[model samples]
Target: MATIVETAVSAGSFTTLVAAVGAAGLVDTLNGEGPFTVFAPTDEAFAALPEGTVEGLLADIPTLTSILTFHVVPGAVHAADLTDGLKAATVNGAELTFDLTDGVKVNGATVVTADIVCDNGVIHVIDAVLLP
Candidate 1:
């Protein structure tokens, strides 16, 4: 299996995500060893943001990096392991809250796809971009 970054690139729907990761210089981090649970947002999710949000973020490396890392947790937490009200610490140092009560939400984005196993981690596709 490919790494999280590779997997997202292959999925094709995450073009914006892939580009953001690159611009944030987190491609190597996501490609590193050990498990990571990423709430991968699709291109459409990024598009849903207010106008100019994406461009503004892309221009700020620190902020962009923080937002990207906010989508990732330290370990590979599968869907079954998620509880109704669970909060996990993200690499960005913020806690990502889970609400399984309504189809599994991270922060505020709903999980559209879960448990996409990668070589060194997992990816859970989210509908909206989670903010930290």
Candidate 2:
């Protein structure tokens, strides 16, 4: 399998996320050996943000890193292993609650795609970006 960066690139919906990762200087960290579970927000999700939000966040390195890390949970959490009302801790030190009873909801964002395996982790596509 490819690394997290490669997998995100191949998926084709994480372009904004990839760019944000690059801006945050977290490309190497995500590429490193880790069993991270990332609730990756699609490009559309970023687009849904209010005007200037994305650009503003990007200008603030520390906040950008925190927001990016909020999408990642340490360890590989597959769809099957995720419970209906699960709450998982993210790499950013925040807890993301999941509601799988009606499809899959991570934080407030829906998981549109699940179980995208990567060499260092897994990616679950989310429809909205989660804030810190």
Candidate 3:
């Protein structure tokens, strides 16, 4: 089993996310011990942002880091564990609301794929970039 960072790199769909993580200097934290549930946004999701959004975020480390961390929860929260209206605290010091009523949604981003187990935690692929 690979770490969350390793798994994302191997998946090939999270290129933008991988780069942002590196730029935000969060590669080491996401690779750390214990468990983390990451709502990873795909490259296409990042591309969906405004034309200059990605470039702007890459250059702004603090804001970029906050946005990145907003997608991560402290524990390994699998889809099965999620319930309607569940609120989970993120490493960014904010909370993500789960809406299981219509599929799974985290802060309005649909979960395209769920429960990707990693050596360090789990990765749930989301369709939009979550902002804090």
Candidate 4:
């Protein structure tokens, strides 16, 4: 199977996310061997942000990287493994709470697509972008 980067690129809906990752210089890292759990936001999610938000973030590497890292957890966590009221710490050092009781909520974003396998990790597509 493809690596995280390749899978994300092929997914087609993560254009903004992929661009942000490249801008943040995190492409190589995500492509590396890692058991990462990524809460991936679709291009629509990025569009939900205010005007200029994406451009501004792209210009600010540190901020962009932090935002990107907030979507990633240290290990691969599949949907079936998630329990109600589970909280996982992200690569950004922030804790993302999950509410599996009603659908699945990571922080405030719902998991729209779960268990997307990648060579280095798993990707769970979310409707909204998560902030740290």
Candidate 5:
């Protein structure tokens, strides 16, 4: 099985997210031994942002890091662990509330794909980028 980074890279759909994680200097961190639950946003999700938003974020490492980390919750939380109204604290020190109604939602984004198992963690694809 691949690590979170490898799984995401192999998928090809998370190109922008992978790039942002690299740009944030979090490649090593995410590769580290972890049971992290990453709420990964797809390239389409990133593109959905307003004009130049991604560029602006990429230029700000600290802000980018915060945004990226906000998508990660420590421990390997699978889709089954997420019940309606469950809230988890993110690695960035923010909280994400899950709404099971009409599909799973993390903060303002909906989970498009879930339970992407990685060697060290799990990835749940989201349709929108979650901000802290």
Candidate 6:
């Protein structure tokens, strides 16, 4: 299996997310030996943001890193590990609350795809980007 970065690259849908990760200088960190649970947002999700939002974020490295890291939670947390009202701490020190009422959601973004296992971690594709 490929690492999270490799898997995301191969997926193609996470272009914006992958680019953002690279821009944030977090390629090595995400490729490191980790059991991270990533709430990955797709290009569509990124595009959903208001005009200039993505460009503004890409220009702000610190903010980009913070927002990106906020989507990651340490440890390999699979879909099965999640429960309604469950709160998980992100790598950026922020917290994400889970809502299982309508499928699965983290923060307010719906988990459109879940349990994408990778070499270093697992990924749950979220329909919306989670902001910290």
Q: Per-candidate TM vs. native?
A: 0.98, 0.96, 0.98, 0.98, 0.98, 0.98
Score each candidate by Cα lDDT: 0.93, 0.92, 0.95, 0.93, 0.93, 0.95
**Model 5 Cα lDDT, one tens digit per residue, 1-132:** 999999999999999999999999999989989989999999999999999999999999999999999999999999888899998999999899999988889897989889999989999999999989
Question: Could you give candidate 1's per-residue lDDT for residues 1-132 as a string of tens digits?
Answer: 999999999999999999999999989988999689999999999999999999999999899999998999998899999998798999989999888777989888999999999998999999999888
The segments of candidate 5 whose C-alpha lies over 4 angstroms from its true place after superposition are none
Alpha-carbon deviation at 89 in model 6, angstroms: 0.4
Model 5 pairs whose backbones collide = none
Q: How close is candidate 2 to the true structure, as a TM-score?
A: 0.96
Off by over 4 Å in 4: none
- Cα lDDT for residue 53, candidate 4: 95
Candidate 2 residue lDDT tens string, 43-117: 999999998999999899999999999999999999999997788899989999989778999887999999989
Better of 2 and 4 by TM-score: 4
Error of 5 at 119 (Å): 0.5
Instruction: Evaluate residue 61 in candidate 3 and report its C-alpha lDDT on the 0 to 100 scale.
Output: 95
Could you give candidate 4's per-residue lDDT for residues 8-70 as a string of tens digits?
A: 999899999999999988999999999898999999999999999999999999999999999
- Report the Cα lDDT for candidate 3: 0.95
Which residue runs of candidate 2 sit more than 4 Å off their true CA positions?
none
